[model samples]
Target: MASRRHPLATFFHLFFRVSAILTYLCCDWFSSSFVGCFVTVLLLLSLDFWSVKNVTGRVLAGLRWWNQIDEDGKSHWIFEARKVPASNMAATEAEARIFWLGLIICPMIWIVFFFSTLFSLKLKWLALVIAGISLQAANLYGYILCKMGGDGDISRVTSSFLPQTVFQTACPDDFQKPGLEGLEIHQH
Candidate 1:
């Protein structure tokens, strides 16, 4: 199931992730200003986060995630996979594999960096390291949920606490919510 259509998204999916890693690994060689390196790495990470959550996952893996607030003002995390028909062009195996690999691997690298920074007592870099870990880990976790529930199981998971209209309005027509028939609304 390899796809050739999303080469550009695949490129950027890995580009920002790899760039952030390289920048962190060789920050000293690239610049003398701690602020410069810190800002640069954060920017790359932010781009990677946005691209993965909003663009690459949707294009390459048919996955998208977001947080929504219900009328009760409660927050809900929605993980969605695009509805694709059998005859449509599904994501290729290669691109999907690359998306998942990049999603999973980057956070592990940041975790290792976290411990290394802690052990070395480089507290100055701790904040930056934590930021990287948080951002990467968030995408990883959301995608995992999105993929796990790709078959519309998310409706089941979220329907208990949320109103049926929430999913309907939040996703509109792009996503598939197969099990919505069984949802029951609870009043506070």
Candidate 2:
């Protein structure tokens, strides 16, 4: 069941890892929220890939995935996995762009929010909340940018998480979200 691992998750794990490390060299205050995103990305990378050989091992693997793996070890009891060609350069670049954006944007937003407190406590709460919300938006933009082919990945993740289809059904990317810099998921 080599199906559970998502390419995006693995990629993001590396990203968050590097970003967390860079938090020391590149910036200051590697805060709890930073750790939270790092941990979430790590958990995603630990998705149970079911490349088992024995029946017992297979069962154990399936059990680890909450019985998500099939007897044939295909699905691995995780979310639907799309097996894009390992050589898909375009998709790879698209994913990199999104991930890099998150790597850059997430920390910057957190840093600003982290320092917004010297002025006032209310600003601290406001900054942290705004930073968290921005992380969600950054995640959505990166995910959608990664998903931008065959009307599948970008639109699908966008619709699932920060879905704008309900409010801006007519917009191509539903890129009309009020607060976003630009809801347009600019594909690489």
- lDDT tens digits, residue span 1-188, model 2: 13323364544434443443344233324455755544543333222111211111112111111224567776431211133344443333334333334433444555554556435564424433354445444433433443342133554555564444333323434343222121222212
* TM-score winner: 1
Any runs in candidate 2 off by more than 4 Å, and if so which? 1-87, 122-188
Error of 1 at 44 (Å): 0.6
Question: What does the lDDT come to for candidate 1?
Answer: 0.75
* Poorest 10 consecutive residues by lDDT, candidate 2: 56-65
List TM-scores for all candidates, in order.
Answer: 0.75, 0.25
Please report how far candidate 1 places residue 9 from its true position, in Å: 0.3
RMSD (CA, Å), candidate 1 to true, equals: 9.4
The lDDT per prediction is 0.75, 0.36
lDDT of 1 by residue, 1-188 (tens): 43477789999999999999999999989789999999999999999999999999988877788878999999777766665444443444456657777887789899999999999998999999999999998887677667556334545643441333334334545544342222122221
User: What would the TM-score be for candidate 2 when compared with the true structure?
Assistant: 0.25
